[model samples]
Target: MNKKRLGPCVTFFPQPTTLVSTIAADGEVNVMTASWAGIVSKTPPTMAVSLHAGRKSYDNVKQSGEFVVNMVPASLAVEADYCGV
Candidate 1:
């Protein structure tokens, strides 16, 4: 048998990529790729998504106080890549 060691890091395979859509104050729709999202509560059916302060969607969410999460399937890999960009 072979043995190897790796440093501490975050690693999760087959993560469900989501396109978080938010509406700006000016009624502009902004979408961004988010992989670090998950269910925060099952009873209330709530989810949590992390966003960078510099991201436009962050401000949009702050202003609108709402967002929609669209899950991306394997078939939409290309489109997901586009959204990620």
Candidate 2:
């Protein structure tokens, strides 16, 4: 029998820059630029985000369970980063 070897360690970005926009029950919409969202469950197509407690988007997420995740390319990275503000 022959044994196979794996390559050395490598680092890479997991996801593209994404801007998540959410709206509260009062219709106040907020956008947050995030690079830390991941799939939480495959069964329901759920996603998890690492949002701080004080963010506007965080409040929106709590008020409304729906949000849109928009991916950004390098050309639009600066614009996407500004969405959180």
Candidate 3:
């Protein structure tokens, strides 16, 4: 059997499409679609999500100190894609 090598990049497919919601210091709400997310803890029901440093959601989440992760169903793929883009 032969194995092929993959390049270094964020290529984890079949990832859960998630909508990350965050609030700003001034009570502004922001939502960001993220595919790089996973459960980090079970006892506290915590999750880990990766976001670009320059993104608004990242700053909002950092400032507000919390976020909400919503899983996207198949029926909402289009809307999810829009948010991700």
Please give the ranking of all candidate structures by lDDT, highest first, separated by commas: 1, 3, 2
C-alpha TM-score for every candidate = 0.82, 0.65, 0.77
In model 2, which runs have C-alpha deviations exceeding 4 angstroms?
1-15, 39-46
The model with the greater TM-score, 1 or 3, is 1
Error of 1 at 45 (Å): 1.5
Instruction: Find the candidate with the highest TM-score and give its number.
Output: 1
For candidate 2, write residues 31-78 as lDDT tens digits.
Answer: 888868877899988877778778888778877778887767889987
lDDT of each: 0.85, 0.79, 0.84
- Residue 53, candidate 3: Cα error in Å is 1.0
What lDDT does candidate 2 reach at residue 67?
84
lDDT of 3 by residue, 5-78 (tens): 88786675687778998988988888879868988899998888999999999998778788988998889988
Q: How many residue-pair clashes does candidate 3 contain?
A: 0
Whole-structure CA lDDT of model 3: 0.84
Q: What is the lDDT of residue 2 in candidate 2?
A: 95
Q: Ranking by TM-score, best first?
A: 1, 3, 2
